[model samples]
Target chain A: AQSVAQPEDQVNVAEGNPLTVKCTYSVSGNPYLFWYVQYPNRGLQFLLKYITGDNLVKGSYGFEAEFNKSQTSFHLKKPSALVSDSALYFCAVRDGKDIFGKGTRLHILP
Target chain B: GAGVSQTPSNKVTEKGKYVELRCDPISGHTALYWYRQSLGQGPEFLIYFQGTGAADDSGLPNDRFFAVRPEGSVSTLKIQRTERGDSAVYLCASSPGVGPLYGYTFGSGTRLTVV
Candidate 1:
């Protein structure tokens, strides 16, 4: 079955430090990868997506993701973290339907 | 509306009761989707509608779960004999189409608590 995997349940990073939330996927055809963030009690907000072009896709709020076809991974990254960036992150892949991975909670410490 | 909208931001219902959660997609969006998100988990696909027809509903767990988008705009997800396991946040999203060009815009969601 087509699926996306977020290996980390929680990731902690000191404010201003670089942060990375890992994700991997298993699908048959060319993958359409996307990243979404959810704040407490709020709906998910789109961050970035990777369809076919460049591997590095930048998105809202200084967020970007690197799509590695060889590794079947689309990891979300940020150059510098902020306390407001702490939220739940989800990695999704579009097969027939949009399949989401177990979310990873990111904590940006002060 | 400016974005997708879901009604009853929170619902606390007794188990075995039936409930309906509503979703109003963004104006002009042709594709609407429903998902369920449990505590500490990501949203799981439940159903998808395209222009008043159910394009895909294979993700719905059982027959008790049904949805309709009669006008291809507003949708209602109906769940019968609700159980404790059904307690989760029901999310509604919409996109221009099912193509890769557009990402989904999700609503705040309706938290259904079955007790």
Candidate 2:
């Protein structure tokens, strides 16, 4: 079965600092990975996706993710984090089916 | 264009009652999906529709949970004999096609509370 793993339950970073949220997946075929952000009381918002071609994919809100095929990883990153950037981040992978990670709560301390 | 929209932003019902949640997908979107999200977990896929047909209903927990897209544009999820465990935020999303790269656009979601 295809599955996604988000190692951290929460990540704390200071405002204006770089942020990183790790994600890894296990799938049988070529993986299609995605990153989504959810604010309080709202549904998941699409941030970015890695389907084919480029390993480094840029997305909304200055977010970017690197898809590493060998390590089965697609970690989300931002150059400088803002306080408003804090939210729940989810990494998902598409096998034959779409499977989501447990989710990582991000806190940007000002 | 407007994003996906769901009706009844919040619904509270007694256990054993029935409830229906509605979803209107983006204009011209061919694929729609339904998911359930708990307090702290990621959304769990419940079903998927391609046009007017249900292409994947495997994620549905049981027969008590059912969904229909009669016109291939709007969809409804009906839950029978709702239990306390069924309380969660129900989300609806739409995509242009089956490709995962097309990433889904989600609605604000309906918060269902079973008393």
Query: Evaluated with TM-score, which candidate comes out highest?
Result: 1
lDDT of 1 at B67: 100
How many clashes show up in model 1? 0
TM-score of chain A of 1: 0.97
User: What is the lDDT of every predicted structure here?
Assistant: 0.95, 0.92
Q: Highest DockQ among the candidates is held by which one?
A: 1
- TM-score of predicted model 1? 0.98
- Tell me how far the alpha carbon of residue B109 in candidate 2 is from the true structure, in angstroms, after superposition: 0.6
Worst ten-residue run, lDDT, model 2 chain A?
A93-102
Instruction: Indicate the worst ten consecutive residues by lDDT in candidate 1 chain B.
Output: B95-104
In candidate 2, which residue pairs get closer than 3 Å at backbone N, Cα or C atoms, i.e. clash? none
- Give, for candidate 1 chain A, the lowest lDDT window spanning 10 residues: A93-102
lDDT of 2 by residue, A1-110 (tens): 88899999999999999999999999888788999999887778999999999999999999999999989899999999999998999999875346789899999999
Off by over 4 Å in 2: none
On residues B1-115, what C-alpha lDDT tens digit does candidate 1 reach at each position?
A: 9999999999999999999999999999999999999988899999999889999999899999999999999999999999999999999999999878888999999999999
lDDT of 1 by residue, A1-110 (tens): 78999999999999999999999999888899889999987899989899998999999999999999899999999999999999999999987568999999999999
Interface RMSD per candidate: 0.9, 1.5
